[model samples]
Target: GVVGGRSVGVPGTVRMLELAHKQHGKLPWATLFQPAITLAEGGFKISARLNTLVAADPHLKKDPVAAAYFYKADGDARDVGVNLRNPELAAVLRRIAAEGSKALHEGEIAQAIVDKVQKHPTNPGKLSLADLADYQPKKREALCHDYQVATKDFRVCGFPPPSSGAIAIGQILGILKNTDAAAKPLQDGIPSADWLHLYTEAARLAFADRAQYVADPDFVQPPAGSWSSLLAPAYLADRAKLIGAQSMKVAQPGNPGAVKTSYAPMPDQPEYGTSHISIVDAFGNAVAMTTTIEDQFGARQMVTTSAARSGGFLLNNELTDFSFAPADAQGQPIANRVQPGKRPRSSMAPTLVFDKATGELLMSGGSPGGAAIIHYTAKTLYGVLNWGLMPQQAINLPNFGSMNGPTLLEEKRFPPATVEALRARGAEVREMNMTSGLQAITLGNAHGKKLWMGGADPRREGVVMGD
Candidate 1:
């Protein structure tokens, strides 16, 4: 089963956060963790979402530590709105807050993590103490691209390689610009079938290039010696030419600058689970972050100092993000194939936008929908920048996207006519659960004063807050 130690990758959250705090944080390091500690120590009400996930999960109950904390004696999930505490997590947080990343990466916490992975009864992992201790977060250049809508130009920035986010998003939007999609506005607050047809076609082309070329930069080189080659205006225009009156159904990867890669395209596979956060602080600092554990309740294995403890956190099945089959039938290696010390290509696109002329911050946004993250984020950017919708209004629009296959729409959200319209174009349309947990905050003018606005996805339990 995917829910066990064999799926776990070395945890990186603590190290990543610590690195960010050290560089940009103004408050004392310990002060930053107090709220989470307080919440875990005191308790928080279980929401409908949590209760439903617990009840629905067939494997969560298999772990003794998780089964006890999240369920009743009868094995039913704890009731919604009931106060639940996780003192063990609180204890873990406290130690980390006090001792920095070392607490988790070097000593007691690291031991517990390694033990949980290596000693799993059914599926054991190879995580070692040295792996945890030696893990170092590397800061890479943010991929920024210039985008224009009508007369306004913006600079969109996103996470770089190892994350196929910004490059893919840039390609989609760039390709759309080469088409007439910009002229087709949203009909009644939702994207029209005409626009979606163009958008999904663009998505198919972009994803084709993604599976063919994107991977950890440390392992695979970008086509034509630069990632920007994929987003080049000339290249996008050529790609746009492929989209005719009908859907292409599936697209083949374009050779940017006529450059061919030795790697084979990764086959289509399931990608799942992540959360997004978009924040604009009082002092003008902003953060758009997307974190994940690769699957729901990730690996379904909980780790604490001891089984006697009632609280702990789940391990991530992040390694599974790699292409399971290392090579294709023709013997060409997949770019995202798993390798030691190599990060898997991901669709987590945490993004920020700035006014190109003045370099002023305009928006911070991102979404969690695994591979659909590219589409979710591109939709919000298009809605706000192209259609002039507010952040909340843009987020409230129904989620939709195509991952180079059948076009997907949020179930029951799109009109019947819209679905039939895509089908008429020889496109396969699937309306299912395209749940996107999108969060966005934009700088806007209100009553002739500068203001900050935030929006969260209503499909999931998220709320916008400000003091």
Candidate 2:
């Protein structure tokens, strides 16, 4: 159901990048696109990861264009290190570089997208050309919260809603702050069972709140009249009180002071696939960007500029991010339910950390793991800020989180004793592959000089590079 034209949303990457470049860009727009154009034209060798994904994807072969591009004449995935070229994408990129976002949003490219979505033989979509032409990227205020570790004070900033990332993370950290979690540090460079128990309990509470109140800010009002109310100390203190030595086993959402809402909590659903980038430039500018197409190979529908369809980009199934069941049995609508012109709620947690005392940019970090992104990012932040581990060390630590249900730990990473200890405390512990693609860069002092320390998650394909 997720892998056809019916799932595609109006593409917005070009428009969003253009908006960002209009404000802070120093280089020429065309010059900025030259590298991508070169790569598309000249091609790059396929990696083991790409080969595996292509081999495993069941829906990709259903699309003629995608099948031809990613597979061989015999229907086998291209071997690793095989050069793959996309001249059609190069042509599209060239037009975009020269003509700006208009090339994609107004003319031939936009028409192609509309035609593909509305005319799909099996499952068609309703995306219109007007939707593409009228699309506008938003610039929202970053959600920033004060965090103190030992004597060091810092400000953690994350993307505001239509992303539940920052609020959920803030709630998790805020709830933990009211508990004895900080007093129990890592044991032997790994999180102790004591610490994990508290952390997962906190995560459960945070996710409950997320399901209840977090959504596109334009469509839903924050609880208690302000987003900060969810993270208020008094509210968190009361929430933390629910965390006993034993797991709460599916925690419920807390009332943040006096709040009134008619919306129902969104039921849990599967979420998957995203990419993360953390970059610090020589000019002291930094960015933490998390981009996604909802599922692997997006809608499994490729949009090419030509009838030949030699090369193209995949369309996003972002509409699926909305709640499948729009309302509860009692008829109360869910906050994240799909609506006309509404942006879907996302778990993309692009984050930045600043030194409170000096106002210096301390870190740019984020991850890609669907709903688990909040936990992955929170883990890294806690590791660096609270536990005093390096960014790489934090990323290297085993991924664990509770999305208000079972406690998930990366398979084979935790000790057997740790697993048994969690089970003994009434937690439904499950060991699975928690592949987190996290990238981070933190400010550091090296030999009395300022340096930027960067880390890339070994769980996925990522690298740290600077000149």
TM for candidate 2 is: 0.98
lDDT of 1 by residue, 1-467 (tens): 46688778888888999999989989999988899999998999998988988999999898888888889989999999999999899888989989999999998889988988998888888989999999888899999988999999999999988999999999999999999998898898799999999999999999999999999998888888888898888999999999999999899999995445588999998888899999888888889999999888899888888556567888999888889889999999999998988888899999999999999999999988889999999999998999999999999899888989999999999999999999999999999988888999899997899988999999888789998
Worst 10-residue lDDT window, candidate 2: 254-263
Error of 2 at 342 (Å): 0.1
* Candidate 1: regions farther than 4 A off: 258-261
lDDT of 2 at 276: 94
Off by over 4 Å in 2: 257-260
Please state the error at residue 217 of candidate 2 in Å.
1.3
lDDT of 2 by residue, 1-467 (tens): 57677778777778999999999999999999899999998999998989999999888888888888999989999899999999889899999999999999998999999988888778899998899999999999999888877789898999988899998898888888888888998888899999999999999999998898888888898887888888787888899999998999898888885556668889999888899999888888888999999887888888897778756988899988899989999999999998888999999999999999888999999999999999999999999989887899999999999999999999999999999999999999999999999999888898999988889999988898877
lDDT of each: 0.91, 0.90
Inter-residue clash pairs, candidate 2: none
Report the Cα lDDT for candidate 2.
0.90
